[model samples]
Target: MATDSQLATWEVFIQSKPGANYIHAGSVHASDKQMALQNARDTYTRRGEGTSIWAVPTSEIAASNPDDNDMFFDPANDKMYRMPTFYVMPEGAKAI
Candidate 1:
């Protein structure tokens, strides 16, 4: 039931250090999550390119709805104090 291109894609992320941010490494195509993980490891970490790795199937992710854009971003602009424009920079300080 699965075509070659229909084999799921898993996004590969790598964390170089314990506290560093995880970065998108690449993607893998496999029949299932388990296989995807193996493929991701073989394809992405062959040379110790990463200290840590994660493989997430692209379909399993649920993202914000584009239709809710207004409500999603409205509150952030309501509070103006969060901006640094109100205060003057200290003496000898470079322009922010």
Candidate 2:
């Protein structure tokens, strides 16, 4: 019997244009940073859609827990400055 030993997992981000923020494209498995970059490019930018690529180790990314939403994000609801009612839009302005 044979089993596959997967390489390190990398999260791929692609920038569609110069100066644009990188958006998550997909993931790739590679042995190292250089290999990860190559894998990301070939897998995600085949049509030359991306101007830049970022390949970050999946283990290195930090994410917030959804279960702690009230503790983390609800405080903004109590802050008066966050209310749009505090500002008046000009008469000719359209609703955003």
Q: Which is the leading candidate under TM-score?
A: 2
Candidate 1 per-residue lDDT over residues 1-96, each given as its tens digit? 756665778888888768677899888898887787789889988888778878898878788998898889878898888888878789997634
CA lDDT for candidate 1: 0.82
- Predicted structure 2, TM vs. truth: 0.74
TM-score of each: 0.59, 0.74
Candidate 2 accuracy as lDDT = 0.91
Model 1 quality (TM-score)? 0.59
Q: What is the C-alpha lDDT profile of model 2 across 1-50, one tens digit per residue?
A: 65537987999999999877899999999999999999999999999889
**By summed lDDT, which 10 consecutive residues of candidate 2 come out lowest?**
87-96
Candidate 2 at 91: error in angstroms?
Answer: 16
